[model samples]
Target chain A: MMEPSTDKAFINLINQNLGIAYKVSQFYFDDAENRQDAIQEMMYQLWKSYPSFDGRSKFSTWMYKVCLNTALTYLKSNKRNKNEPLQENHYHLPSEPENNKEEELRLLELAIGQLSSLNKAIVLLYLDGFEYSEISEVTGLSKSNVSVRLVRIRRELELKIKQKLNR
Target chain B: MDHLEIMRNQWQGSGKHAEFTPFQENEFSTLIKKQMKKQNHIIGRYFWGTFLFHILIYALMGHVLIKYGIVSSDQLVLTLSLFGIALTFPFTAKLMIEFKKLAQVQRGSIGVSTIKSQVEIRYGILSRYFRFKKLYDYFLIPIHCAIGAVLSFHIFVPGSFSYVSFPIISVFVISLASCWYAIRSENRTYFKLPLEELKGILGDFDKK
Candidate 1:
């Protein structure tokens, strides 16, 4: 029987899945401050649902479900006016210093920024090498629908990335 | 290379980092602890509230029966024994299940909202489903009423004597008042986060 130390167990599990939080947060917000908020909100959700994680599915799968769901919902519900510029702390892109990957990351970030929240999930899963079936499992999408969305997403991302690189 | 492949490389190369970069280790731990405590507090309220309310209901019933002499002293012992054995475990189990259901509902809301926006459908039926926390509250109400009924039985029964109007009326009024206050206070506190977050998010979603 598992001991009921929720705090200890939850913190450990979250630490293991930290990358999911980072990726989802990065995808959701351009500003550093907003990114942090998104990450924190995601943490809140994960911890709240920690008790129900029976471990039948992989931890990462459950986390992906939690993280993607939180990010998209948070984006939908974000009430801050777009007209207002982000405070310096809030408007930040993830840094990519000292690597051949910088330009690629910048371009990719731009591409993600252009997608709707749901489309972003499909793209993230696709980019992460999630097959249609796995993507459907994590996202609760039908396999056929996941395939269809990924096709559209590929077209959209290519156009967006090309425009960014050209600029 | 395909768009998906290009993104895969970029995402992999972006690297990984702690989510709580802005906060020091101590500060981050403290924050997580505070959040965990808050959740426990909410769970405790629901559990104990159900427990106490059930006790109150039986107390009231016992009192009325005893006053009428419809029940002997030995019968009082039997009723308590049956209630303790039969109801306690079921109530706690139900609360645990309710907690799980509540979490699922919350997750479901986020998932549905995300899918809805992506598919770009004009309308959806999610609003018809039970909100996670609201369903939790609904389940809590009957448990509380059952507890109150049990407690009332114990409290208002007139064993040796048989006059009931005043005591029964007062007991009912007191139970109703207490239940109302508890419901109002707890509902206001429990809903503060979801409603605020939902309203803000829904407002932004509407603008799109």
Candidate 2:
């Protein structure tokens, strides 16, 4: 049982870092309900594991590990059930009534959604500005593996975006 | 300049606009408690369900011993009950231990190695149990039936053991062959893909 003050502190911390949850959930789950469930599960795991935080790493780094792990587990379990259809390319078309920036961003999201789960994770971490070593640490991939994968992922994304632009 | 760079900037920028319903402290605490309760329910169900299944098996076996009274002596019944318990206890204990290990896995602050090890342990336990169960059904059940047949013939017919043995043996051979075929098909269809996926996940960590 957490003390009220500790609970409040934890709540504040989560509130501050909530964007990490949002971004990670959005990258993995296309639908709103699954995204919400993923976020809730992530927060619950973070709260359950909060007492183990030893201040050795940045809180965001620790949070990223928890979030990504939870998201991957969620995705796998959902796949087993095969209940909900995965929401691919659910974004508005480039011709929709949005500015070019929003359109391009939607295209990029759709393209990322097309990548394999592992590649999607690497690209998301890369976009979030994690160094290769940090990506390796979080993902359990060796640094060289992370480097090679990132180059391939970048080229894959470029090809995907180019195809989207042509369309 | 780069397409990827542009996407990253957009991610950082539009991420600010990702709307979420922020939870207050009390609400967050309530949510945490609710989730914890749900997790406890899932874990508790698995543990108790397994426990009750073993108990039910023992109860059924005891009922069989009482109803049949094949050996008119209480000592024989007690010995058989003890033997049944001894045979089943190992499997029950192992399942309980695996469930406990699964429950005790550190939730939030777990490292990659810890996660990988836990998953591997779970996969190993489950696949091993599946194979063991298949073998038990294929071999042990028929053997138990044969023993029961011989004992019943010895008690009731006194000299018809030879007569009963032939049919029992035939039944046993047919069932064993059929079970082997089923287990082989199940290994191919049910177990192979998931085990391969688990192995792939474990292999990711082994790369230098």
Candidate 3:
């Protein structure tokens, strides 16, 4: 596995799934610098954990698991200051929808960003089309709990998205 | 209707929600090299370095016992050194055992079927690691200091300066106190927050 050809193959596989890191980091970090750092850490962790891949699960599923786990464990560099009334990272719906479609997308991001860190991971999995079992397996929650949480999360998200849309 | 349908596109490939810069092999190689440097384990180095210091202290104490003989004026300090070595040896061994456990912890939890289990496993290992470290800091450091202070004072300063024996006790107190403060602060800075965060995450899981 340490051979040059193997390294190239591994790198190629990682390159293909690099989007997982990008998306996971986007959900996890508020600031761009921290997002960049998160991506690097996730990639490094993926490489380190690559040998244990076993190929039993789909590579993308495994990649998401590693990325989510890394993000969960990563200490937030932008943790709110106790005295500050403003949260620089806090999500806000814009006063004016500059462009209808972009605003909807932005609102979606804001609503999701505002979820609890655990919920963020859950919703990320759901929106990415992961099954209840797959989400439960990655999150360590029971299948029933995953179903329950997703139902609540979906309802909550839809309400927010619709209200923001004024539909 | 899947009102949340639009969000699926948001989470998937190369969207405004998720921006990706393709992987650069050179940047990754540099980062990988840096991580390789860290994988050398600074904590491991520190412990081994401390172990080397212990070896030196042992040699010094052994020489004093040989040079001064048990019945000499330095008998009291020799006996104290023996006591220090006895107490310190067990803690040193415990620290080494903890070190090995730490190595395993670094390897991280496997079969991460659930994120909760992974967090819990890491938390459990790290809490145990910090506990062992705290015990070593509180007990072993003081004992080792006493051993070193007593031996160094005896070996370097002969009978002519024996009247200054008060200084040996004073020096031991000062070193022990300073080390106590230093280690306490270090633990506070490094261990306190991470452990609390881990605990909080576990609590988040349990609150369900």
Docking class of 2: acceptable
lDDT of 1 at A127: 67
- Root-mean-square deviation of Cα positions for candidate 3 versus the true structure, in angstroms: 5.4
Candidates, DockQ: 0.14, 0.37, 0.32
**Candidate 1 local lDDT, B130-181, one digit each (tens):** 2533454455444445444444555556443235545555666676577668
Evaluation by lDDT, superior candidate among 1 and 3: 3
Model 3: residue A163 alpha-carbon error in angstroms: 11
Q: Distance from true position, residue B169, model 2, in Å?
A: 5.8
* Per-model tally of clashing residue pairs: 48, 0, 1
DockQ of 3: 0.32
Better of 1 and 2 by DockQ: 2
Candidate 1 interface CA RMSD, Å: 7.5
Best by DockQ: 2
By lDDT, highest first, what's the ranking? 3, 2, 1
- Each model's C-alpha lDDT? 0.57, 0.66, 0.71
Candidate 3 structure quality by residue, lDDT tens digits, A13-117: 888888788878767776667777777777767777777777888888888888987877644412422212213245455567688776766766777776777
Model 1 / residue B91 / CA error / Å = 27
Deviation in Å, model 2, residue B38 alpha carbon: 2.5
Output the worst ten-in-a-row residue range by lDDT, candidate 3 chain B. B104-113
